[model samples]
Target: MLRALGLAVLLAATTIAAAPSASAVTRTAVGGGTGIIFRLKPTPETPTSYYICTLTAVGRDSAGNLVGLTNAHCFIDEQGNKLVGERVYRDTSPAGTAFSPAPIADSRPDLETGAIGTVTYVSTPNNLLNSGPKGLDYAVIKLDESRVAPTSTVGQVTITSIGAPPANGTRMCKEGHRTGLTCGKKLGTNGIWFTHLIWTDGGDSGSPVVSGQTLVGNAWGAQHSSPILSIIDAMNTQGGVGAGFHLAT
Candidate 1:
């Protein structure tokens, strides 16, 4: 829903039952900085739609379910609506597949990596909550054990723990799928965003905002960020899909 976000689309409602992905490789790491796919089908007989976004962090919930984080916008539509049955896949695009108006001709349903997670909890313009992204826009993804090898590192940045929002003038960095690794100073405010000046773009949604090894903020759009520490508190308070989350190390 933000200006810097990209939307990857592939709609094939006619395809019944996705075949098992023979090409679905076991990802050594599906934590922060990884590229992921979100798929949705209006009905069993309708076409499935897929979108692309970046994974922020992966670990487990209080229930011990393997889970990850990203922006809720990735699973929502232009009208600020969420697809009821969105499923997540490991995006294998070498160049990154940020969403645009038209579906990428090659961006077919990539069951190749299999479905790794489903959106367990989310916050978007359509469904903002007391624990939602109004304070920090984010989504909680429950990862499938079969499709991922969990780790805490986002690219080269190791997320050892959650941290407070960086001071306005503090230094920060992010590992985005589209922008790769970029760093800048904590700049703006007046909004829930940490407001870093780092280089961000579409498809970089949910990229990890880190201060050294401490996970701090989450990239909201191309230019805005939200506090990961705040999101964790919100998720736990919601007592839903991602309640009681812990970062995997």
Candidate 2:
């Protein structure tokens, strides 16, 4: 039997309070869940480098194609440095055995455990001046076809159709690399404005926030004013208040 990896101790020094707080929410089974964990591997010349991130399995886009959603900030830094997309891995257990990008053909890692994926589309950060700063902090990535075979651990993801936000107090959930799986509830929503009180943390950024098959939002900024400041909704334009963009249907 394959064992899931144990939760790693979060680092206090780099931890962000804006993330959801820890909780005892029941963890759902992996295969039909909402999130997938991916680890970015550094090249031999960059052995000291490390990169890991999470993604939400949003429904299909406008064209009816499957798409995975995540925060654009998760892929790059404020300085425009690529933070994701070198090579990624998913752990099979806490023992460190992982399914990473294979070095050659025919020797590929088993997909039933987990397989590698690639960063397909990364959105440019448009400052509020263009549309307002709260715009969608989201991006779309394409999993490697061979790695994403029917039997792969990171199964196909679906992009949600745009629609009205979920009612207040509705249940929500997310899958993340660091936290594994967690659940929460909707606190409020108005137009593109949304706020949720999920139990996520650092490495939890870029996680997709979903309500059922609908892609509600992505984890972007945390409230600095509250105990667990809520996740702010991405504005439509760069600066104006509106809902973030989803895969065009």
Candidate 3:
């Protein structure tokens, strides 16, 4: 349960779903504000831990792969380390029609539960801190099209456009899996980070921050004082897997 308040978790983590049944008909709905959890074993003696976070967005990469966005911390280990090929699972919670991951200390992950995606790209901790004031704290997950029906809307919030961060005092809302939908006015933007009056919870990392249909940033912390990561700056600066990412149509 890392609160994910840190813009960059310590050093660098250079490391680095769910399917529906046929009878169920509808596939798992994965998009912005989706609750997701990933496991970390760390070592053989240590018990595996399930950490939860929110998915920011779902879209296609420049290479045409179905990809999703979230805070890089969601994919990292206890020490905040990440592995490139690490797997990701969904935490549909109690509201959705899917398996909810119950963390068992030493029990193996429910391999029966399908993985939604694998980590394709991450803005490493070293890179985040060194990348300047607004260091990117995001990760891109290459999703499985068969397991999910990707959409840009989360609940009542629909992300129809991607644009620059809104001006100071502009209204902003975030659709998060943990906290649901909460909104406030943008406090201000400094460098690559923007402060907001929004309230968030521990598992709300990577929640999409939007102004109307335009997505402006990603929730980066649990408190209102924590700055939001600018999505446009992150993508433009990183310029690789997540480059030119747009909301799924």
Per-candidate TM equals: 0.79, 0.51, 0.73
Winner on TM-score (2 vs 3): 3
RMSD of each: 4.9, 13.2, 7.3
Candidate 2 Cα misplacement greater than 4 A, ranges: 1-46, 58-66, 81-115, 124-132, 150-164, 189-193, 212-215, 221-249
Worst 10 residues of 3 by lDDT: 6-15
**Best prediction by TM-score:** 1
lDDT of 3 by residue, 146-218 (tens): 6677877776679877777678888888877666788888887544567788877666778888889777778
Candidate 1 positional error at 30, Å: 0.5
Tens digits of per-residue lDDT for model 1, 182-225: 78898867465667777777667788989888888788664678
Q: Once all C-alphas are superposed, what RMSD does model 1 give against the true structure?
A: 4.9
**How many clashes show up in model 3?**
7
Candidate 2 lDDT, 1-249, residue by residue in tens:
000111112121221112122242222222222233343222212122333344544333333334455555556543566544534333332211113321111111122433344455554432323343443445555444333332113322233433444787887655444454455777775334466766555444455555665545555434100111122222223222112324433
The numbered model that scores best in lDDT is 1
Off by over 4 Å in 1: 9-28, 40-49, 95-110, 126-135
- lDDT order, best first, reads 1, 3, 2
